[model samples]
Target chain A: MTNKTPLVELRNMSIAFGGVRAVDDVSVDLYAGEVVGLLGHNGAGKSTLIKMLSGAYGADSGEIFINGEKAKIRNPRDARRYNIETIYQTLALADNLDAASNLFLGRELVTSLGFVDDDAMEAEMRKIMTRLNPNFQKFHEPVSALSGGQRQSVAIARAVYFDAKILIMDEPTAALGPQETQMVSELIKKLKAEGIGIFLISHDIHDVMTLCDRASVMKNGKLVGTVDVDTVTDDELLSMIILGKHPHQKEA
Target chain B: MSTPTTNRSAKTFFNKLGIDLRLLGMIGALVILCVMFDLITGGRFLTPRNLFNLSVQTASVAVMATGMVFVIVTRNIDLSVGSMLGFIGMTVGALQVYYFPDIVGLGHWSIWILASIAAIIMGACLGAVQGWVVGYLTVPAFIVTLGGLLIYRGAMWWVTQGQTVAPLDPTFRLLGGGADGTLGETLSWGGGVVSSLVAVGLILASRRRKANHGFTVKPMWAEGILIALAAGLVLGYVYIMNSYTIAKGALPRIAEARGIELTEGLTLYHGVAIPVIILLVVTIGMTLISTRTRFGRYVYATGGNPEAAELSGINTRMLTVKVFALMGALTGIAAIIASARLGAVDVGLGTLDELRVIAAAVIGGTALAGGFGTIYGAVIGALIMQTLQSGMASVGVDAPLQSIVVGLVLVFAVYIDIVYRRKTGA
Candidate 1:
């Protein structure tokens, strides 16, 4: 997988707010069909770093490359144009609107007369929801009526439907129960098999260990290190996350 | 999945109605108000003549309230609408009566058309300016529109030098519903019949569409009742307006004194006001924008969660600007209607309307917290407000007491809305 150009790469990214380095001197890459776990504690700058690529925030200093091509992501629209989409922890959905509206938020399906083609969008949403979760049936209710897992499914379906090449999911399973967590795990595997790159930011070591092929840990405002999940033990990854040091490099 | 479809033990009034709960709540409130006022006024409040007047009087507020629902839904307040109304009214009024009064005398059709277009453009510009400040400059809307409220009001007063402009062209006054601007008896009947047919057709089409989509719809009996009620409301309004006979009343009295026989049944009901027609168009058009357009959805989304909306590839800042701009243009339309309605423009044209407009939107269910509201609700809110005003005035309530009553009602409506939302967990 490393032999090909990465689907997305962030080189030497840094940003500051009020003279404090929130995300400083970090680098990460997501290859096609790979899930890269961005492991960090609270305020570990994982969100800030990923936001730079998602176009939620601009980097003060960095170079972002997609498909080995230089990119300029000045805004969320720009990021979307590059086929990059982010599912923020909040799911970035309009609670007052039903699944169809939320799914097509900025990109609504409209008739030739310029009116929103609501029925068509609902049909499309039904198709995707069926594909993603066969049990999901609450199509008419506003997303606020949906459960956490159902909302997550809608969010995931939105990204996948948009044909996002680089997907950024923040805390995908942080609030789910065991059943929902399992559903999410299955979805991620399906996405992976479809050859899409994903940056999954998580705090759970167990989740990262089982779901991610590689883990990049961050502490304070900088990267601690990246390690292959097969090569590093759970304790080694935890040590790097909390202590901000690579145990394997120190031992070498 | 465990959530109950309906809480039987805690069956709320809205649940009992069993339609779109939010929509039902608004309709129920409006109906309750009309009934209460009808009882107090000895059935005078629901008289067609009074309802007709009330609807015309509410035209401006209803129009502005349409835009306001969007503004409030986006979690933004436009304090300048009243002042903008005043400013645009004065500006447009000046163009017709003072600046280009002679153009119409030359028999050219450009005065009304040109002036209206210019006023709409001016309104859009003013709104865009405010939107820019709030959206891009990062100034809070409260602060920007607050400043605009003062500045525009001052500007309006200064423009007219506290003097009133009057005698707008006959054609221009049509926009305001001046005597000659009304549809009169024949047209009123015509409009009523046409609208009744259209309303029924719309209801049938909607029912058919729902069925086609395999969507659950209200029972046929309920749907038929709703359609009948809607059509009845339209035709009934026309019948009432046609009852005010003009030819036989004062003209007959003079002819009798002069010993000359006059035509017997020359009735001239105050026909449907032109401004009311304009208000109807605005209502329908805005309903479309609110329910069937991306801009409308984005407004709700932006208000629902600013951060989430932004992350979802929505340009909330630009959406904010557009929402305010649209509000500005509506205010301009309102200004035109208000000034035309009175056949004059003065500094007091839209005085204190900001409070009334916002009150209408809030009463209509647009939450100050944002994310929930409807254009129809706002229009109904305006109607309710107008009904209260007309009802009080007819009963000879003191002006000061009337205002106090209106204020209390506004607060009470909002209180009910909050309590209802809490109980329903909406």
Candidate 2:
């Protein structure tokens, strides 16, 4: 696997907020068709690290490479230009806008006169949403009126509809029901089969064990280790999360 | 249970017609207010002459209020608008009366056009500068515009040393539309017909577009009813405007100018005034901008959730500046109307209009918390406020009492809006 260039590589990424290193010198790589689970407790800086890659925040120091070429990502627009899409845990959505408006908030479908084509956008939104969640019927209603699962579905649909090459799902199934969660797992597998790379942030060890090819653990804004999911047990992952130590590292 | 079921059905009915319930409630309130005023004033309030005057009075404030919808929609306040209006009016007044005549010779045809262009540009630049302070410097909008309010007012004082500029050019004064500035009967009828046709066309076009896109459309009867309603409104307004006749003393001059032989008891209709027409154009233009443009979409998105907007790669800071610039440009137009209508620019021009415009937007159901407003709502809100003021005057109320009543109405309107929003969970 090391013989070929990985799809995305983050090298020695570091960022600080108010003199505290929120993410310190974390390096990770994901190959094509791979699911890398990011496991960490609260404030473990997993989100911060991913944010740098997603262009939500600029890193103080780091280099990101895509397909063996160094990429500059200073903002969310740049991230999108690189075909990177992030589904934030908070499900960032404009509460007053309808589903289609939120789905195409920044990038809108416009007619030749440069007017927003609401009908076309609605048609497109309905088409994708039918495939993502066929039960989602509140197409004209603001997302705030939607249920948690429905909102999650909208966010997922947005990320997937854009044909993103690198997908970042930050706790994608955190607010979902069992069936919805199962649907998301199946979606991840399907995207993987299409050669898309996914970075999954999860606190659930079982999810990481079942859905991920590799697991990278962090604690206190620092990386503990990266391990192949096939080799590590759930207990070892838990200890890494809680004790901030790798399974194979010697204890002093 | 029956009540709840009926309410749901009513909501669904309006939803099928593609009408906002809140907007319908506002229009209903306006109709009730007008009817009550007409009754209390012994039928004087609904007279064509009074209504015509009321519409002309509402034009300036209504224009500014339309822009305020955008400003407040983006969660910003532009307190400088009133002072900006005064300042731009003074500058335009001076340009037309003094500088332009000197440069292009007195009574040059281009004087009015040149002065107007200067006023709009000046207002936009000033507004953009204030926006820069708020967006780039990270200052709160309230402080920036508050400072602008004082500075522009004082600047107006400095222009011509607080002396009122008067005797504006003859052609320029037509924009204010007193007697000679009206469209007259034939043009007014033509305008009404054209407006009705366009309204019907838009409705049909949108329905066809929906059907073409394979989306469910309103029933044929609903579309027919909507078209009829729109046409009725246009024709009704034109009819009222045409009912107002000019004074008898001016009849001979109008007849002679039109090359008609003067006859006994000949009457001439004063159709829609120019200022009101200007106001209509502005209202339609602003409505289209708010609903149909990408810039408008960004405004709502940023207003709805700033973080989400930024995450979506919207240049929200720049959007703030652009919105303020739009507000400024509208204020410039308002200045032209106010100054031209009064036939001069004075120290008290546009005084306290900032409060009036903001109140109109808020009373029009624009939430101060942002992300909610409509252009038509703001215009109607202005009309409602103007009705209260004029109605009270015609009823023999003192000026101070009129102010008090208007203030109370503003508060009441906001309270109603709050309850409505909560009830609807919007």
Candidate 3:
């Protein structure tokens, strides 16, 4: 996988807000069928770095390459044009609209007359919800009435429905019970099997160990290091996160 | 247990009817208001003549209220609408009285059309300018429109230097709805039939489409009842308008104008005012834009959650501009109706209409918090407001007391809405 061009590469990305270097000089890469875990504390800048890639924010300096070609992602629309989708920690669902409306928010399915094809969108949503979360039966209810797990399913379903080539999941399992978390872990694995590159932002060591192929740790807005999950123990990853020290550097 | 069960079944019935409970509540309130006023006015309130007048009077404010739905739904208030209406009305008034008569040689058939288009465009430009400041320059809408409220009012005064423009183009005056501004009997019935058919067609089309997608559709009985109710409303409105005969004093002039000999019991029907017709078109069009189109969806989504909408690739800033622009355009239409109806323009043209328009929208169940409002609701809200004022006037209530009552009603309506939302967990 490393021999081929990376599916997405964020090289030397940096962004600042009021002189605070929120995401400073970070580099990460992911290939096809890879899950790259981004681990950090509350203000560790993992979310900020991923936001730039998702086009929610622009980096002061960096390059994002998709399929080894430089990509211009000036906004979320541009990021979508590049087939990149992000499921934010907030789930990003409109509380007043139903599941189908939130599912196809920006890209609504419209009839030939240009009216929103709500029935068609609902039908499509029903199919996707059955596959993603079979227990989700509140299709007609606004997303505000949905449970946390149900909302998470809707968010995940949104990304998967769009055929996103690069999926960014920010704390995907953070708002779930054990069973729901297990379901998400299985979902990540299934998506990985289908050759989609994923950037999973997580604080759980167990999740990164089991779900990600490479774990990248960040501290104080800078990259600590990236390590092969198979080569690193849970304690090693924890130490790297806590001490901001890279064991891989010592090995080199 | 029985109470809860009954409530649940009633809810299910309403849901099956496909009518929003909030809208149904407003309709009920309107009916009750009409009945109360009818009784208080000793049966004068619900008469055809009064209803016709009520509708025509509702047209201008109702049109602006529809636009306010979009504005309020996007979590913005356009305080400048009243002033914008005044300014636009004065501008259109000036064009008809001074510019078009000179250019088109007076009484040209195209004067009304040209003036209307010009008014709409000017309104849109003014709205867009304010929208740009709010959307791009990041100014708060309240402040921007408050500034606009003052500026446009002053601008309205500046037009012709506070001079009242009167004796508007005869054709242009028709847009305001006098006896001449009506569609009359045959056309009103025709319009009513067409509207009823369209209403039924829309209901049927949506049901068939739902079935095509294998969705759970309303039962046949539910569908039939909804169709009947819609048809009845359209036809009933036409019947009321047609029942309103022209004033006996004006009949002689109309007879002379139409080249008809005066006969015993010559009657002229004011089927529907042109302004009312304009309001109807605006209502339907605004509803479509808010519900069926992508722009409408973006407005709601942005209102619901700005961050979420932005992240979903929606250009919320542009959406805000378009929403305000649409509001301004509607205000322009309202301006034409108002000025034309009065056959004159003055600085007081749209005075305090901002409060009335906002009150109507809020009363109609548009949430000030955004992302929730209906076009029909706003129209009904306007009617309710109009009904209250006119009903009070007919019963000889003091003007000051009428204002007090209207103010109380506005606050009460919002309180009811909050309670309803809380109880229903909507």
Candidate 4:
């Protein structure tokens, strides 16, 4: 991992729904040129914590520091303005549109006459998809007709294409097969090489151990601890997740 | 799975037929229906005069349906279009009769243009209200437009004070699709030739463009065939229109002044109706708007999945309002046609036009569930509908039977769509 300053820091973030804390006082930091794995069980507040940064859900209380400066992200538009992008677990693609349309959904490239420059967009999509997933070629097919892995390519392509500096991906590989996953791992490694930070919300320890430099585990709306993946074995992280107890700190 | 593969298993008979199977199926059905009607009507249905009249008849509904396709594609409906047409027709008629009776033709055509602008503005305002209710206020469109349908119909009656406004200006009536209300023969023939040439040029240009981008496009033979078919249809229309003759006394003054000595039986009353021209223009414009605009993408995306569109930072509500407002403006255009055709406007001006417009869109393969349709499909759908109504009359069918038959056709078309979807596993 690079010994550079953190790209983003979430300090004392909290939000509640219907009088219950979905996420409580979760603090996580992602550094430039590093992959931070957010590991948690379902309903463990990992998704909720990431949602705040993504601008999908505004935190009731928290401060977000980006490049050591306070930032306000009230909605998805604001997040995108900061060059932050998120690939929701759902993929969130319009089913009736072809791959090119879905890739540039809200932000379309149009000619001077204001008509969409579809040919241009498609050509650009081809270039990016070729690099991201060399096998992706369903440029004209609606995402609904595509397989799960193809859909992932579209979602990932959208986030990756638009000069993203901080990417928050939720279960991006859950639906992908091993080959596609490998393709994605390569893409992520390439992005990291370019100095972009990524927060990977994943349930699979194998992926976390292999891809992420550091792992931050959360349980019952609180952080167990953050540890270097090379320092802890899979069992140690598993215990941290299940027991909500840090490896170095004894339970209260 | 990175490679794009044609799903061989899903390639049914229709898939083998063309890229857009549903559209081809619709055209095939249209051909079959035309042939059946012609045969049953003792060949009267295919007569040039009848076909010409059918084109004029299809104009107003086709115009509205083109707009309706956009609305339906966005998962919304505009049931108020019929009433809105009637209201605007009456309003425009009232303006011609009561406010601008002194204004006549040609040099003073500016009045007509101004009136048209006013009517379009009014229609848009009306549509914006309903769109706002449905899109912003979160009221269901079905309910809002249903209310609009009734309210505007009543407004039509109230505005004209329960009286029919008649005897619109001669120049104004030309916009209604009358025999004298259209392009001159030479102009009509010229338009056909030019448009056919344009079609060829556009096709070739698009092909060249696709090649430049190294994108896959239709084969040369396929492109040739499409261009041939389009040119054939356009030229054929011109040939038929150039043959129709009007009575000498009924001929316009310009033709009489041209000093061409007519042979014993040769006074041409034939030309393309202005309304038909308007329909063509609307079809082309709507086609471009629906296929090549950011607004078009939003409409489709909003219909396909609202939640996904919302998360993608699209203001779906604003898009909905814009679509409905556009629909309203097209309805105004239809209003001009209906009012001009009748030489008057009244409460009955556009009665039941909404049904025909919606049916046209649905029949043309636009899914009521949204996210799938084409403007050209809706136009053809309108043509199919008008052909059925006209053909039934030619066959001496009773009015009740005509109604039942058209109703059945609507349902049958939708059923075919459902079956086709299932067959293709779409």
Candidate 1 per-residue lDDT, tens place, B102-169, comes to 76554256778877887788888899899999999989999999999999989998887988988766
**Global lDDT scores for all candidate models:** 0.85, 0.92, 0.93, 0.87
Query: Which clashing pairs does model 3 show?
Result: none
* Selected candidate, larger TM-score, 3 vs 4: 3
DockQ of 3: 0.86
After TM-score superposition, the amount by which residue A175's alpha carbon in candidate 2 deviates from its true location, in angstroms, is 1.6
Mark the 10 consecutive residues where model 3 chain A has the least summed lDDT.
Answer: A243-252
Q: What is the lDDT of residue B13 in candidate 4?
A: 30
Report the lDDT tens digits of candidate 2 across residue range A75-96: 9999999999999999889988
Instruction: Write one digit per residue (lDDT tens) for candidate 3, span B1-426.
Output: 469889989989999998888888899999999999899878989999899889999999999999999889889999999999999999989998899989988889999999999889999999999998999999999999999999999999998899999888898999999888888888899999999999999999999999999999999999999999999988999999998888899998767765678899888877888999999999999889888998989998998899999999999888888888999999999999999999999889999999999999999999999988889999999999999999999999999999999999999999999999898776
Which candidate has the highest TM-score of all?
A: 3
Tens digit of lDDT per residue, candidate 1, span A25-133? Answer: 9999999999999998899999999999999998999999999999999889899999998888878888878999989888999989898988878888989988887
lDDT of 4 by residue, B271-390 (tens): 787999999999988988888898888889988888778778888889989999999999998888888888888678788999999999999988899888889899989999998888
Predicted structure with the largest lDDT when compared to the true one: 3
TM-score of chain A of each: 0.96, 0.98, 0.98, 0.96
Per-residue lDDT of model 2, residues B1-426, tens digit only? 469889999888888788887789888888888899889878988988998899999999999999999899889999999999999999899889878899999999888899888888998899889888988898999999999999999999998899999888877888887877788888999999999999999999999999999989999988988999999988888899999988988888767755678888788888999999999999999988988998999888888888889999998889999999989999999998899899999988988999999998998989999999999999999998988888888888999998998999999999999999898788
**Residue A18 lDDT in model 3?**
100
Look at candidate 4 and give me any clashing residue pairs.
A135-B2
The model with the greater lDDT, 1 or 4, is 4
TM-score of 2: 0.97
Model 4, TM vs. native: 0.91
Winner on lDDT between 1 and 3 is: 3
